[model samples]
Target: MAENAANLTATLQVKPSIFEIIAQKSLNDILQPAFRKLAEVLATNFPKRFAWLNNYCEESFVVINWLLQYNYLKNYDSTFSENFYGFKRMCVDGKSLSNHHIELSLLFIVLVPYFKRKFDKKVTLYMIEEADGYFKQASILGTNLRRKM
Candidate 1:
């Protein structure tokens, strides 16, 4: 009976199915309340940027979900889990700062965890250049503004 059971178990392929892949891909993280509130502020203050904010939120959610799935599948922790929490905080701080470049920095910082998370699972970030480009780091303020404003 033990031999039969082992054979049966072995014969049954336990690999993930297409449905499982779809389900995993559909997973979404619960957005933190603070993050939601910040999004609300962004929507109110910069309605034009609201679409960007929503896109960012969705991307972040997908990243967190993917990381959680990878961690479960591999039976291990990932840097994404460690970085997600910190990334949110950094983004908020960057957004609060008056510097435009820092605001961009904050945006990219928020995206880093997502990029790493997706990359680990062999998924693309879609906008590769936007995700890993030095253009984001360029200073927005001019020399004259540095002295006056």
Candidate 2:
């Protein structure tokens, strides 16, 4: 009985992964007004984009809540992606009009796998950053690129 108890204690003390920590914190913050606003924007401005955003938000909520409930925030880095534009103009137009600059970072992390699955030679994921005000224009660039494909 004592040996079993010790094992249980050890197992309970195991550290949580970083992804778990980020997931938990994300859950706690998921209901914030900012997140809702972002969701609304996605639903209104770009219905097609809403599918991915919804998946991301749901996943993030689950991950963040799990971390917080288990008190594992200190064990992980909490980085998450935020989409700059949605279907509605309210979310990004003000920023675009404010002289905000948009910066994009392209990552090849999943591109190779995606390309392989599609029997294509290349794929790319673009990360976009913009000053607080110019998100709309940046999103426009993303839309244009998507249309070109």
Candidate 3:
């Protein structure tokens, strides 16, 4: 009985994974409003480029929410850094991401794998099709020639 209790306590105290933490927080806090705002901003700022997001209907919300959580692992002299913006960590309280700051290529790169794993087949296909244009635009406009691919 004592062994059972100890094991139960340990199991209860198990820490959530980083992915869990981000997913829970993002779903609760930023999903709806961010989705609406992203649609409005994308339509207003880069209408021709990001216009497909508006046409995605309900799925656009999920796709935008996923894209906003862009992160990449970077290694610097053996130290690893995770560049993430999902928690609004870099923003003033209550502010969402601005359209001007959206990095299309990063969204394309990060969201492909994320959608594939998290969403159903139909949604994933739609998201990939939409993001392809962003990827190509990023390739042409982005200053870094190495990232052109």
TM-score of 1: 0.24
Model 1 clashing residue pairs (backbone): none
Residue 63, candidate 2: alpha-carbon lDDT: 47
Give lDDT tens digits, candidate 3, residues 49-116: 87877667357665554444443211111101123322222334535444433354345434554466
- Sort every candidate by lDDT, greatest first: 3, 1, 2
Model 1 over residues 8-123: C-alpha lDDT tens digits? 87546646467644454333223333455677688778889685675576465545544443443233221233233221122345443234544344345346656665586554
Candidate 1: segments with Cα more than 4 A from true spot: 2-12, 28-38, 41-149
Global local distance difference test of model 3: 0.52
What ordering of candidates by TM-score runs from best to worst?
3, 1, 2
Using all chains and alpha carbons, the TM-scores for the candidates as numbered come to 0.24, 0.21, 0.26
Q: Which ten residues in a row have the lowest lDDT in candidate 1?
A: 81-90
Better of 1 and 3 by lDDT: 3
Error of 2 at 114 (Å): 34
